[model samples]
Structure formats: C-alpha cells, structure tokens
Target: MLPSDPAAVELVTCGKIEIEGRLVDASNATLFCGISAEGVDAKCVYKPVSGERALWDFPDGTLAGREVASYLLSEAAGLHLVPPTVYRDGPFGPGMVQLWVDTKDGDDLVDVVAPRDVPAGWRRVLRAMDRFGDPAVLTHSDHPDVCLLAALDIVLNNADRKGGHVLHGTDGRVYGVDHGICLHAEPKLRTVLWGWVGERLPDEAVEALRTLRTAVRGPLGSALAEHLTRAELRALQRRLTDLLADPVFPTPSADWRAIPWPAF
Candidate 1:
C-alpha cells in the first residue's frame, strides 16, 4: 500500500533504499525498498543517469529530469496520472525516484483485453502481427482517465507511450510511467490513447486544459524551466494553447510515426 501522506512518501523516496534487485525487463530501472524515519515503508523505481542509454533525439543524462517533469505536469494539471516522482542525488548519481505503484493482480488494462474481444466502450486503433505472427489489435481505454492521459501526453510531447506504461494501481487509480522520453521540443506524441481522436473535448477536459495553460506561466512554468530547455517549455505552452483553442482530439499525422514499437 502507498503512504496516505504525500509528505511521508516524499521523505521515504528521498531517503536511502535497500536495492532489492534490478528489473531485467526494464531497460533503465532499479527496484528499491525503503523505510523513512517516520516508519513509512515504500517501494520505488529508481532510474539512474549512469544506466540510461543515449538516444539520438534526446540529450544524454536528461531522461531522469524528464521523468520528474512529467510528474510535475500531471500534478499541475490535476490529472494525477503519474506517480509521485522526484529528482535527487542517488547512489549512482542524480536520477529520478518514483513511488512504485502496486498494480492490481499484475494486470494492466492492456493485458486484460484481447484484440478480438475488446469491450463495447473501448476502441481499437489498428491491427498488426505480434512477434510470432499472431494477430493483434492496438487499443486504448475509452475511460475519462485515458482521455486525460492522452491530453497530458500532448502537452509533454511524449515520444514513447507504450501500452505497458499504463498501469492499474491497487489504490484504484490508473497511473502512467516511464516518461523519460517526453518533453521534446519537436512533435513526438505517440501513444495508444488515440481512441477519441477528432472527438470534441468534454467540458471538464477543456476546463482542465485551460487551468494547465494558466499554471504553466506561473509555478508550473518555473518548475519545468529548471528541467526542460527553453524551446521545449515553449513548445509545451504552445501545445496547451493549441489544445485549448481547438478543443478536439487530433488525428494521427502521416508526417511521423503514430505508435511506438512493441505496442504492448
């Protein structure tokens, strides 16, 4: 279970953790379990700068900061889709430390549904072949949380939003993770949450975007300015303005790849 108090959780995250083990499936992550002075025990995912692989598009050693920035954006927008994340000096150097979400039955929304058996409310984006030549369908949850997630991704310029990045928390919330590849200055919105593309934005969603637009110039902007380049931050602000003005989900563009590889 996660700590009820955000402060307690933050304190635990800032404190030292006993490295449980490295998650082999994770390209760049470490698992740690720790207890704070206040006796708050927590598990966290730690992404060390040293473990990060250099990417052609993104600057080296900046992925950890991007993770923290994603969390900040989620909090500022009142989406709360991302788990609590912070950047601090760790044993391996400066990196991102995020509260580990205890998933329900280890089943994410993506894992529970079969392409052919997609529920009435969900929408399938495309059909493709899996590694073994099996048929597969890419889909997204049609729930409001997913709509907010897509909007958040647009604002962050997220380039790698694979299905596995969306998790169902034991606390009865949906959480998005692995935002190290987000916040690029260029257009790089890729995700499975395009089910509502071209649909008119709901009133609540419009209001949320507007709120984010105002916040970006204040504390939100100041906080992100530290992690992202001026160009990147400006791009984010522009996205907010565009979304607020259009108030519609955008269709996939032919100019860039719309989905990440290994969709699930």
Candidate 2:
C-alpha cells in the first residue's frame, strides 16, 4: 500500500476487506481495513457512504463518489498526488477505498511556527497570534511537489485541504487525502496551501493542466459526469480553461472563508 502501484487497485477492488480498526478522529466513520487477494495483502481506508454526514452544500451520500472522482482527476492530470482510490462494495455497503500511504515521521509540509523561527525555504501564509497571544505564522514548504498540490487543490475546488491531509509519503511523494467536499459547482476553495499565491505555477504543473484540459473534454468528462452534475462539470471545464490561460496561483477569495477552520 505504501508504494500504491497499479496492482493496489486490483487488490482494493477485488480483495477481501477485514475491518482492522476505525480512525476515530474523522468526522465520518473511516475504517482502517486489511485487504487480501490471492496471497497478497495491504492496508487501506474504507469510508462507507452510509456513514457520510449531511452537509448544507453537498448532497447526502455523495462524499464517497467525490473521493473517487478526485483520485481520477489527479490521475488524469498525471499529478499522482492522490493515492490510488476506488469506489466499490464493502462490509457496510458501497464507499471509497484508498491505498494507505505510509508517511515519513517528523516530516511536515505545513505548520504554524513562531514568526522568528520560520524555516529558510518555507513560504509564509498568514501572520497571526496564537491563543496565548504569542506571535506565529502559518507556513508551508516551498518544494515543487507541494506547489503542484496547491494547483491540484484549485482544480479540485477542495473545501478542506487541512494541513494534516498533506502527507509526506515514505516513497518521497507528496500526497493529498480526504477529498470528500470537492467537485462542487460553487467556488468554495478553502485550503492551507495559499503560500504561492500570485506566483507563476511550476513548469510541470502547467504541463499537467494542458493534459487535463484534453482529458476532461473526452473520456474523463464522460466518466466524471456519472458522479457530478452537469453544472459542476461545466464549472470544472471553465476552471481548467482559466488556469491554462493564466497559470498562476490565485489569492484567497473574499466570498468564502479561504482557510478551513481547525486547519491541522
């Protein structure tokens, strides 16, 4: 599961899933599962649609499909930022199952640090005072992979890109997880990755966007329509077009809260 290769998909899709435990901190029922297939085994997270909580903006029982859609979009763009995810039947019914990505301990891509102690290559996001009235700043690494994730969040219209959702994989890749509130028609892009606002996107991200533009027009668009509405699909196309025309990280919008509360 750590490497999350193409075989992981087959394992997650056809493997027998055993509920190992539950991730208690998740808002919904997120099960830690052990999957076995033809003598192969791996770990994954299973989120049953029946456990999804209703949201005022997002429809009920749609979060699981949205998670799968996010993974598909990431793969279509050649971003590979999201771990292999699939929507299939589980013990509790249909839901999203994603490969478990093992992280590198003590390695964090985003953090809230003392203003004076901000790392040399990190980018400052917000300057504010902590609960103790001590000065601090929200910061994230300036690594190219981190920057690419920021762009991916923009396209996803991801409403919950919490710092904890960004993982430093042991495979030396930056992975983003927990994308249930994405692919909405509205412009609700809240995230902690606002460090690169107003800057030009990395060359690789631009190429990814170009590839996505074509993919979204053909088979990808048809596939996503099964999970998303027509309006949402149109909005996705427009967002892609806009980004390709002007490839820059956008600043926070005033219409919505730009940062998710309890960011970590």
As a whole number from 0 to 100, the lDDT of residue 73 in candidate 1 is: 83
- TM per model? 0.92, 0.98
Instruction: State in Å the error of residue 26, model 1.
Output: 2.1
lDDT of 1 by residue, 143-172 (tens): 677777877888888888888888877766
Each candidate: what lDDT?
A: 0.79, 0.92
Error of 2 at 145 (Å): 0.9
75-160 per-residue lDDT for model 2 (tens digits):
99989999988899999999999999888788999999999999998999999999999999999988888999999999999999
lDDT, residue 132, candidate 2: 98
Report the Cα lDDT for residue 1, model 1.
Answer: 41
Model 2: how far residue 203 lies from native, Å: 1.4
Who wins the lDDT comparison?
Answer: 2
Q: Report clash pairs, candidate 2.
A: none
